[model samples]
Target: MRNARFLWELISYRPASASCRTLFMLACYGERIVFGLAIQAFFNTLPQHTQMTPELFVLFLPWLIAIAVRLIVVNFGTIGAVRFEFSAQALLQHNLFKHILQRPGFQALPDSVGNTISSFRDDTAIVVELLSHLGETCALIIYTSVVFIILLRVNVLITLLVFLPLCCIVVLARQAQKGLEKYRRASRTATSNVTGAIGEIFGAVQAIQVAGAEQHVVAHFHTLNAQRRASMVKDRMLSGALDALFGNVGDIGTALILVLAALSLTAGQIRPGDLVIFLTYLAIVSDFFTDIGSLLAQQTQARISFERMTNVIHGMPDHQLVAHHALHIHDKVNEESAPPAVPQPVVVPLQQLVVRDLCYRYPETGRGIAGINICIQGGTLTVITGRIGAGKTTLLHTLLGLVTADAGEITWNERPVADAAAFFIPQRSAYTAQVPHLFSDTLRENILLGLPEHEHTNDLSTAIHTAVLDHDIAALEHGLDTRIGVRGVKLSGGQIQRVAAARMLVRQPALIVCDDLSSALDIETEQLLWDRLRTSRTQTCIAISHRRSVLQRADQIIVLKQGQVEAAGSLEQLLTTSQEMQRIWQGSE
Candidate 1:
């Protein structure tokens, strides 16, 4: 029943296309039946004869014509099926990608990258094949029904004998299906683990080499690979066993029909021509049963794939941010006009930002921020500082709606922070993680992602300058056109951070939430970046930084101790009253 629902979902992707393919499949089956009748006619024309007469030649003509028609219909049917498979595969991949992107954030994804990739590629392909088999299964049912009716008319006893064995095959096949499903699911999971391990190892190849842990990594990979191989072998062995059993059953059924026909012919109960037609139809019936067995076996694998993909597409915890309709900032801009005259880029500002006793805990460890309260005024700089493991990053993530809060409320301009109507541009609230990620693309493309090409020129230049990345761009051979390589490997650590900063800047967000934006930058560059940011525009800046320069410039400084706010005030005020703040200040100096 679950398999039926999965099949229906796949067909519903493009019902018209599926219908067309099914029609062609039916035509192919019809041609096969006609070909069998043609053979029966040829036998009737030449029964107990040796000479080739004009009438025999005429019978031969229909047989030849049936072969020709079958060839054409089979070709068209194959073409239609291939086209449908390609289309369905493409749609499934697109939806999988979109669904992954719409997930709350990276933390919500499957633990292993390989597992997701398996669903995206291997599982989707399996489901598409399942769709093809399902269509063929339907066609085979109709073909088998017509052939059985013909056989019954020719000799009811022989048809009944063939039908009883097939019912037994069905019962046996069902039992095998349960075991096949369990093994196939295990095999798929093991394969995903192997894939994920390989992906992770390759991604961190440099780290492995640097740490001189090549042997250890390979050992772990071999363990996963061995598990995959064992599971796959078991799955294949079971499937082959079922295939052999079904094939033998079909052969026995064929032999029984032939034997029955011989006896009937000797008894003068049926003509030789009638025997010929019965044998031909019986062959079709045997082939149909064999196909049904194969279909059932494959169905188990497809069901596993379908369930894996469905979980990925639907398992994400509901995120209010994703539910909110994206506000197109470009739509509000005057596209025809020249760039803005302001020397410093202008950003849309949040009217008021408020957080009341927000609390969130990590699911695994049950440790996170608690009773965190702070007010962020629009167009001001708010800096959060603390020692390691103080929950600064967690607090930032909670405010950005990347992680769900256990309790408390966050509002912007008297509206719930998650409300769609609260802001026209969600990009107005941008976040830069502590470790910035860069795609393997041109520098300009990375900075201006999702923005129109027209908006890229002047805004990109301004953002590059603001992030202190202009010097790095100037040093490159291709300037902004240079491909940065994976994770910006070609650039220095500081340059990668700045590129991420520039990306956030280009959006001209009303609120900029950055985590350790200057961690990789030199003291001088860090000072310059913050100085420029401070005087640039009225955009509210909330950042986690330890730099004395940033602390001095912050309008409000939040000092966290463990998961709770230890101090909140102007830097000087905190330095005077809080021992933790004093210690942090002294350490920085």
Candidate 2:
């Protein structure tokens, strides 16, 4: 009884679909009651010479009716509950995904993508097992208990004798649960490690191949798999031991009960029919104890899976700020209209960006830039240059309010952008990612991304020309209407870069931030792109680049070293005055 209470507490603690759970529990009890009564009726009806009264007939009829009703109800209820669980899993997966994409480039990564996929596919499936298996376990327990109660009424002494051994087995089984749970938890961790390692290897496949480290990676993967397998083996061994121990003890108890019955029958103390019924009930009682062991093991497994899922759901960074701002955007746009049916913005933009003593730390690693300050004036092409991993990417992220700056106040114009302002083009830009995620989508529709039914006339021809994509696109059978394949794989690297550039250019945002995107282009192409970019009016551009050709066009060149600014000046000034710049130029060229 205490074990049952604990199980119920576990279920209720993290209840999924309360109404469904309640119905499932009720259905379980009904099933057990119906089955117990049916078994009892079969015993009573045997040996036709025994007196069969009207009350017994009434009892027998109801038991048959109840079992039939329970079968239908339980089957339908389980199906509905499972369907609901799957639907909820799908919704959660979708929301987690969309949330990550909305994050700034700083927080985006290859690992986050894999984690989301695993959570949806692997994690959710485990949770479903918890629901279905746990439900069935509860039903089995109730059915077994009902039979045991009937056995007790038939012969109190024999009933107590059987239950005493069953009680000992239950106590021993519960003791084994703690060890099983530990192994189960280890198994889960090992599995996660294997998954995480595989995700990392796949994500960095290019780097691994370049470094010629396939053997090393495979060896590491094997070790992770070995650890996971070892944990599973141990868990299974412990579970098997519990099962064997319980089965043996129950067998002995059954033998003892049978001997006592035979002795009683020999002495003419109990009828043959009654002794036969006692043995049948004894079997049911033994099977129930075994089921209880199965239930406990399953519950432990569910607990492990639930704990893993809960960690992820709770580990995600808060989306509250984004939600608030999205609401703010709607509010501001709507306030200008009569009746105020839409949301209104309470803040306006002056368009200058100022960073005062900015600092940023990677959330998990606690390693990043600190004590940085810069001002980005409107209407100039500002370039940030740095050695690899020198916090160039971090700075761009800091400006966009992506990674939370540890100690910095970034204000737009004079007002802080705890409101709204900039659009950041990450280091990889839209070129490498699924942005403007091409569909069977028209070029116009893809670019506009559902702006409005009336707002569908945005032509990319001029922007395409500016981005040097005119010639390439014109060769296509449908020109701008040509379908770009998934991730734009059908396009060359340069062509995809140009299309992405064109997409960003067409937006004409107040601030355009680019990161290391010009590294791939030839000198002439880079120069041509810059000439076109120079024509934009009243928009600030900040680009991170290593190429001298790209840097020549910058109004201000900020050089970073070891997460600090080595110098900030024009290209000519940097060449003459910055030692790090001189070294980099001499070495690279």
Candidate 3:
């Protein structure tokens, strides 16, 4: 029942092609039935002819024409089936990518990058195979049913006896299915781990070589590879065993049918032609049983793949699940009449943003920010400073809705934060993460990502100047057109961070949230970056920094200690009144 539901949902991705898929399958079955009838007709007329007589020719003509017509239909059906399969595969790939991208926040992905690739590549291909076999499985059942009925009419007792062993075959296959599923799941996981490891190792090959850990990394990879091989071998062995057992059962059934036919012939209860037809039909039935066994085995693997994909795509918190379902239904109902949703422009409120009694805790360690209260005024630079692990990053993440707050109230423009029209980092409110990511593209493209092409030239120049990256760009051989390589490997660490900052600036977001944007920059570059930011009085800035220069320039400063707000004021006020703030500033100096 679960497998049936999985198959239905898998095919539901391409509803328009459903009819074509069905018609193609029916045509295939029709071809098989016609071929079987042609064989039966030839056998029935064989004993009556010494050579090809006119009467025999007349008898054969109808079967020949029927076979020819079915063959033509089969050819057309094959073309349709292939087209549908490719189309469905493409649709599934697109949907998977769309779903992954649409997930709420930066931490939305539930699997490693390699696992996601596996789901997109290997898992989707498996689904296509399952879909193809699903159609063939249906056609096989119909053909088997017709052949079995013919066999029953020929000899009821013999037919019943021949089919009895199928029960045992099914039971054995069912038992093997559980083991096969377990092995396949394990094999898939192993494959994902190996893929992820290779990606990580390759991306950091220089570091590995520098650290002299090449042998260690290879040994770890070999262990994972060996595990995958073992799991795969077990899965394949179990599937092959089931197929062999079913084939042997089919052979036994045929032997029993032949023996019964011989007895019936001797007793004059059946003619030689009858025996010929019965044996030919028996072969068809035997082939059906073998196919069914193979289909069942393949299904076990498909079921695992389907479950893996659905779990990743659909698994979410209960509230999120309900919201997702409601949104899906809404979209489906209004899809035809409704215009596509355009992203609304980010409109920063020109009023105070307030956080009161905000609290959030990480599940793993049970430690996060708690009872945090602060007010951020628009058109001001607010700096949060603390030692490492003081929840600066977590506070920013929670405020941006990247992490759920366990307890709190955040208001923007006197409205609840959830109801307010404010963009978070990497969206309308641009963010430069502590460790920024850069694509392997031209510097111009990287900075101007998702911005309109018309604004590209001006925005790119302004952003580079603001982030103090113009000098670096000028040093590059191709200027802004230079390709940065993977993760901006060709650039220095400080340059990568500035490129990220420039990317944020290119968006021209009213609110900028940066985490340690100057960590890698020298004092000269860092000072220039802040100097440019200070000149932008119309934009609001929220940054995490411990630099004395940044602290002195901040319009408001909030110091955190052990996940709680230890101090909040201008730099001078905090330095004079709070010992912790004094220590932090003195340490920075």
Candidate 4:
């Protein structure tokens, strides 16, 4: 019932479109009644009216007019269906993306990438496919009722005989429901498994080769394909059988009506023209049963699609999947006109930021930051340094709300932050992760990803210079316009880091957070990077680094060990007082 309601909500998403589609489609189907009556009249008057008689011509005229009318009705009905399909599809995709973006940045998605793709592409489409048929189904219902009344007036026994097939069709459809739903679900699952395995194979090609598992991988792929083939065959076979069953049942009913009409004709109980109309209307009525069967089958598949979509979204309410939202189908404004101005974000200067009792633990490993504390005043460099696996990256991720904290309090200039992920955005706090992500686009676009080039043109230049990427990019043939291939794989490791740093710096956030920004740079480049950053005196910075140049220049240095802050002070003080700090400092040498 809940799934049915969701489908109804989608169909009626744009009421205006739904109404036009139904009205126009009815006009199209209503033509069938006009033509049916005209044919019956012509046959009945054949003995009374000679060739080219005015009476028969009168009936012929309406049939001709209906032909022209059908042309227009089908055209408009097609328009309505097309518009509704696109709008409903846009709404579902919009909601899916919105829900996906709302999750914590550090949390992995519930489904594999291929499965999510299938949910977005296949699952959403099947639901809308059911919606597309609804207009015709409504028109057919009205057409069938009118035909039923016409036939009942002609002969009571024949009317029941003609519609008996409809009952059989309904029973068969009910019987096929379990198989239809089960096979559809199995087919979709098998398809998802095959697609997921393909994605995994692509991502792990190097590992597979290193492990000499090529044959094993091939065997696994073959297995998945076999499963998909078997499931699809069953699904299609069952669906086809239902269609054939409806057709054969309708044919048997038609034969019975013809035989009964012949007997009545022999007894002079019915006119020959009455049999013509019966056959004519019987074809249309037969269509109603076939369509009803198809609709019931599609309903079963649509329910399965909805269930899969809900799973992709981590069990979000089914209504959310089809929730009504604005679908900007077309641009209302003229292209020659100026585009609307974008509003800039508000920026507040940071006096100091404080964190107390911040804690988070990995459920799998139970080794994450715990009860961490820190304070940063404006215009100072605060470097967080630690050895490998010391929770340096985790601390940064936890505080920034990329990962949810188990317990914490964050104060930004005396204001408490309720949501770190939402609050720590561009112009407030900009962070560069240790392993940065880049798209297969030009370096210029990647650097100004969030910041508009025209608005932040100067910020672009300053950030490039600050991150020491200006020299590297200038060395390239196309400079910043050069396309960095997928994930910046074409660039050296150091260049990728610098491009990411420039991306973070361009926003000119009040607080700068970086995780091992210098991990890939050489000593001289690292030195130059710090020198450029120190030149900016008003912004606070928290970074992960173990370089002596960074250690010596730090306004405060924090050393982490085993998920806790072991010591925190200036480089000189930490070297003198803390054994853990001394070991870390010596280890750097």
lDDT of each: 0.79, 0.65, 0.77, 0.85
Candidate 3, TM-score vs. the true structure? 0.89
Clashes of each: 0, 8, 0, 0
Task: Provide the TM-score for each candidate, comma-separated.
Answer: 0.89, 0.77, 0.89, 0.90
Off by over 4 Å in 4: 49-52, 197-220, 312-318, 332-342, 361-367, 385-390, 546-553, 571-589
Local lDDT at 397 for model 3: 82
Sort order, TM-score high to low: 4, 3, 1, 2
In model 3, what lDDT does residue 334 have? 56
For candidate 4, the clash count comes to 0
Q: What's model 4's lDDT at 98?
A: 81
C-alpha positional error of residue 145 in candidate 3 after TM-score superposition, expressed in Å: 0.8
Instruction: List RMSD in Å for every model shown.
Output: 5.4, 6.7, 4.2, 3.0
Tens digits of per-residue lDDT for model 3, 1-589? 7656655664665544544555666565665556556556666777877887767556556556766766676677777667667766665566666566565454556778888888878887787787787777776678778877876776787778878777667766777777878888898999999999988997998899999999999999999999989988987788778778877876787788788878887898776656666666666677677777777777777777766666557654312211211123223555476656457565755467789998989878999999999999988999999988999998888887776678889876777766221345434477888989899999888888756667467877888899998778889999988999998989999999999999998877778889989989999889999999878787888999999888878999999999999999998799889988988887897
For candidate 2, the lDDT comes to 0.65
- Which 10-residue window of candidate 4 scores lowest in summed lDDT? 335-344
lDDT tens digits, residue span 1-589, model 4: 9887887788778877766667777887778888888888888888786566676778778888888888887788778778887888788888888888876677736778888888888878887788877777888899989988988888888889768757866786888889888998999999999999998897667679999999999999999999999999999999999989777766776798889999999998888778988888878688888888888988988888877778766746767887887666765757455465555457788888899999999988999999899898988999998889999999999999988899989998899999998888888889988889898999999999845688889999999999998778889989989999877867988999999999999988889999888989999998999899889888889999887888888999988999999999999999999998898889888
Q: Indicate the residue-level lDDT of 103 in model 2.
A: 55
Name the runs in model 2 displaced over 4 angstroms: 1-60, 87-116, 200-220, 243-256, 267-287, 313-350, 363-367, 419-463, 472-492, 506-508, 582-588
lDDT of 1 by residue, 1-589 (tens): 7667656765765666676556677776777677677767777667656887777666556657766776786677677667668777776676677776655564546556788899889988887887887787788789888888877787899889879978887787888788898899999999999888888886787899999999999899889989989999999999898888777766788788788878987899877777777766666677677778888877777778767776677664322101222223225466565454324333335778888899989989988999998988888899999988999999987777676678888877767766322232335667789999899999988888757768567877888999999778999999999999987889888999999999998877888889999988888999999988877657889999888888988999999999999999998799889999998898887
